[model samples]
Target: MSRLRVGLLANPTAAQGTAHRIGRQVDHLLRLAGISVVDLSGPSAAVARARAEDIRDSLTALVVVGGDGTVSLGAEIVAGSPVRLGVVPVGSGNDFARSLGLAVNDPESSTRALLHALSRPVVSVDAIEITAAGHSGPGHRSLALGNLNLGFDALVNARANRARSGHTVRYTTAVLRELRAFTPLPFWMEIDGGDRIELDATVLTLCNTGMFGRGMRMVPDARIDDGVLELATVSGIGRRQLLRLFPRVFAGTHTSLSAVDIRPVEQLTIGLRHGRMLRAYADGEPRELLPLTARVLPGAVRLLAEPSGSMTADPKDSQ
Candidate 1:
């Protein structure tokens, strides 16, 4: 392997224990490859990011050993910097990793893939900078590794995030339950500084990799390095229509539906037209609030992904 100084970060309790086990596996393999590995898995996500930020100048790569949430943490630490981002997907939702052609739920294969990636040069991909104010305080910024979900998907994510555990079953259950209470959320969207368009959407998401909810393809044409974002929404749908439309998402065939719309833009602004505030979610974590501004930051991150001309993380979110 080439000369490498890697920082491995993992949440011990992530994915019910897979993260801890995989972190050790990653560390062992890196050392065996004659690469120096640093344990940056601090007590919490904040600590881990702080540690990474402190030593980022010395590290060639920051490898996240968990799911999409943990990967988002690594991106927060490394985006727009010299350090390359690496992923070992052991989390419940490896949505961010699947697009890179990496193995899921298999520790040996995923770690071996990372080992292979380390021997090659990193790949450049786009990131998103989403900025919005909190509900009661000043605004904060967040990096999105996979997507920024609004409407029904964000509603589901908000529910999943509040659970004792973040899992596919939890998210899926939330999806089912939210369907009953979820109404058409009317919002105003201004894409690329165009006029604000009013629409009621059931599932509206700004996608990077187009994969979320544990490999469900919300936007099949989304490309990580495309230098743009896709605003995907399914509007004008009732409960029964939505029920059938959602299953098609897993097959990536929902786009064929007339109600489903996908628009590519460099920047977008979305907010509630009237109702209560709708929370924004990315990679199953909550951030900011509606009246959010998001844009694509092309080539903001470098990743150690399996070569396929595509595979991607986050830019510094604006306040």
Candidate 2:
């Protein structure tokens, strides 16, 4: 067997320090599986990411022990490299971990699932490469492994992230807070090198792994390895109607609604028409403001996940 060194990177305070609590268990499990552990836990995300990249040449795998934001760190470091990305799922929304059929909020079981994934074939997944034209210098380019949120949903994700509460509760609270002042924004978008069209979008997200806000299937048919990304938009609806549609998102039945537009895009450029301020967030982390371009990179991530039965399991996954 080849020697394995798995860098265990985690957020100590995610889910109220549950990530650190679970980190110990995950570290123990990896050691038992004959893998050497490199603890990469840091007080902040920027420190953790910097450390992971500094030693990326030595690690065989970088396993993130938190939610999607933590996964974002791992994906940024190991994407297209020999290192594989693993998820342990202890954050507010374990969306990526749930995508792999792992049990959320259960550390030991999820760790065991990680071990199982290590022994399996590498699962190559697509990722989004987002460029923020508004920013200059080295930080302008980034990777979004799950989904990118724009318009109203981006506001909700940013709001929910600030609260110190459970996943569903914070998301619900954020939705209510944002709804009180919600209005459609004028967004201009171009797909596949085509002409730009103006859109009055309330919620716009470009999906790779899809689900966000814990279990909301913002794009039901999106597959991470399908060589494409999903541009899901919600528009032309009142606050009451949007609220009614929110519940359906969890079940992925909102695609049936006329207000929802789902487009399979390989490349797209987006910006505000009137130059208003609108931020785009990827993997639930703030990426950049408007004037953004994104494209799908098929097989960009070598994910440590099971090979089958872990994606789009809902019967209503289709529109």
Candidate 3:
């Protein structure tokens, strides 16, 4: 058998450590596995900065070590290519890893689990392609692998950006602060030529995977290989309703709320009716904004996941 060559796309800020420390841990683990590991350095600007084509050309598998943003970047870069992608959840919200049954928080265990996954069966997962105009007054496209969120979640992400720490405590502290001042934005959505829904929504989420921030099940029925996307929308509601529905998301049981509208479609476009510069977030990172097209990329990525991580048996999957 050919030896496994792995490429690591690491983010020290997201890893909650200095670059040197994170690099040493990664290098030591990969060496222990007898696998060749290459470190992609520099700022965490975009996957393009890593010279993705070269990594794909040389590595047998590429592993992303950071939060959902880095994972999303890796997904956009390696999907549609033949390379297999692995994830080591080191960031604050390891949402995708939860869906894969990968344990969170322990680096040593995560590394071993990922190495074991590399030797197991592989599965193809879906990704979402988001097309938006560049802020530089030019037209361009952006891609996201996880959920695309608006309103409250976007606000939470923005607030977290200003935080001094990158841990879960920082995220929760920001969420509490944002909740006190958060308000929904007026927006409209069109799904697969369906009727338009106008709403002043607290949050709008498009889910390709079932997990959301820190394991919230905003889209309880979302599936990674179902060839469709689940749009979970929460209308403007008071603090009481919001409080009641928010905590239940961690258990994938948020569909109980009356204000939620779940729509499954192959494509959708979202726009702000007033042309205001509203914030949008993809995979917990900010996006340009409204008037964008989201297309489904079915089975576009080959993922190395724990043998027990398959969502095929979950009855809640949105197929």
Candidate 4:
């Protein structure tokens, strides 16, 4: 077997108090496993990405030691490259890590599992390619290995980003605050080259993985390697109904409601009819404003993971 050398990238802002501590543990573990660990972490995303690019050639795999945003940053660099990606879930909303069957709640176990996975073959997974409607610059395009969210949830994320406390508590507080002032806005969606369908919606999500917002099963049927994207929309519901349905997302039972629609597509174009410059979030990081096109890039990246049960399994169900 070839010698293992990994580039360790971490986002210190991910889980706050525990990220750095867990990162140290991961670094030590990888070294103990006889793998060369290169520190690619930086004070910011831009600096981290620069560091990753600088050492991409020497790495057998790039191990991400933060949350979904940290994974997204690593994905941007290693997506089409030969380097495979591994994740240790150290973020508050470790949705992508959960999709890969990594232990989300326990960093020590997750790091151990990741090390085991590194000793095996890699698996290819899908990623979403997002581009701004009128921007053709290099930075205008990006990749997401998880979900892209807009509308109500994005508003909550914006608020949560500004807060300085616990992730779950901050997110919950943001939800309540936004729910008190937010309203459904009109949006036009075009799917797989289909005609435009306009509607008023409170939540719009394009998913490659099944979960977002820590553990919300927004698209329960989504699979990262399925070579397709899942589109989910919630409309025709008042704030009261939406609040009631919100918790159901954790169980993925909200899709059974009449006001929600879920479908699979290969590409999507979304624009806001109200001319609101709503922000879009992918992998828990902010992206450009509205009028975006997202498409599935099948088997775009190789992920280091052990074989596990299907992603369609219920979250409440035992693994």
Candidate 5:
């Protein structure tokens, strides 16, 4: 049999210093396994993506070493392509890795597991294709392998992304800070060709995978292979109730609350009423302002993950 050839893409800015070290270790391990490895590390996302695009035709798989942002970049490169994608979770909020049931918080183990999975069959999974209004120019679309979120969650992510220190705590602090000033926004959504429904919502999320915010089960019943997106909406609630609801998300028990609504959908158009400027984030990366359409691209990409057993982990316990 021919030897396996894979490309390694490492995000140098991911996890501050952890990603670079993990990439080196993973590259060493793959070499020991007799796999031909290509170092695709770059100074920025654009360069890294360009490197992947240049080498994609020759590689059997592309292993991304970083957080969700790095993985999101990889998804864009491999989406609709024949190459399979592997992930090494080494970011602050490894929600994508957690959603895949991949081991997080440990680089060596996750890298080993990724290698083992690459040796087996690749798993086909769904991805979200996002097209924002007024941004449909060539190469204007975005891809998300995990979840897309708006409203208060997007605000918190924006704040967290701007912070200069900490990981999970940064997100938590952002959430707390934003809650003090956040109010429900009027959202209008058309789901799977259904009628447009308007409601006051604190947050809205479109999920290809169930978890976000470092393993919060925002949509507990979501499945990556289901060929459908999960829409989750949280209605207006007081500050104390919102705080209480957030902790429950780690256990996926927030779904039981009356203010929370979750449903499976194939496509949706979302916008804010009164033309307010609303931002949406996919895989923790910011997207264009709202009034966008999103659809589930069934089996759009192949992922290398755990072959069997449960891959999902409790964020609370892991943290």
Candidate 6:
């Protein structure tokens, strides 16, 4: 048989030394497996210049070596294209990568798992499309394979981006710092003609996959190919309540809490009361705020994963 052509799009800033280490490992492994690998690391702006269709025409699969944001960008490129995607989880919150049963901490094992894909068939997964009317330009939307979060979750992500400290310290510190000043916002959600549920919420997340923020199971029962988005929200809960409920995300039973709600729907619209600049994040990167619609873009991307049974980890959720 012939060699399979592969492409990689990585985030250069995820970990201090992630780029160099992951690049060498993946390149060496795939080459040993007789596959051609193309590396695309550095500025994401380059994605606009690179023709994904042209790359897809030549490559058998495209592998991403960064965080959810980088993978989401790859989804935008391969949404309607033919190339399958492989993810090497080397970023600080490898949520989607974790969901893929890809190794989050073990580079060698993950590369071995990825190499297995060369002889395997591709798998299809669901994604969400978030459309927002921003301050300028045509209204926009981006593809997200893991989660679309609003309110407090968005605030945490924003802080993580602005943090001057290191990754572990930055995210945790931001969460604790924001908790002191985090003000729950009132928003309205309308799902598929369902009555609008008004809420003063700390966090409202529409989850496609089961994990986020380094294995936080915000949506424990979420399944990417289920043809629906699992909506989970924590309304106006106090810090004590958050502490009480945080562990349940890992087992997914937090939904039973009076303050938390979990439901599934095909589409949903979120709007703030006074139309404030409510932050929104899709797959961990900041996107435009509310006055937006989130709809399911089914089978939007092709991903590589071991067959379901070979996948380890209890599907237990703690979100």
Measured against the true structure, the TM-scores of the candidates, in listed sequence, are 0.91, 0.92, 0.86, 0.92, 0.92, 0.88
lDDT of 3 by residue, 246-278 (tens): 778777677877888788878887788877677
Candidate 6 whole-model C-alpha lDDT, 0 to 1: 0.74
lDDT (0 to 1) per candidate: 0.81, 0.82, 0.73, 0.82, 0.83, 0.74
Mark the 10 consecutive residues where model 4 has the least summed lDDT. Answer: 310-319
Q: Is candidate 1 or candidate 3 better by TM-score?
A: 1
Separately for all candidates shown, the number of backbone clashes (residues 3 or more apart, or on different chains) is 0, 0, 1, 0, 1, 11
As a TM-score, model 5 comes out at 0.92
Worst 10 residues of 5 by lDDT: 310-319
How well does candidate 2 match the true structure in TM-score terms? 0.92
Q: After superposition, how far is residue 86 of candidate 6 from its true place, in Å?
A: 0.2
Query: Considering every candidate listed, which one attains the maximal lDDT?
Result: 5
Clashes of 4: 0
Could you tell me which residue pairs clash in candidate 5? 101-311
N/CA/C clash count, model 3: 1
Off by over 4 Å in 4: 310-319
Of 2 and 3, the candidate ranking higher by TM-score? 2
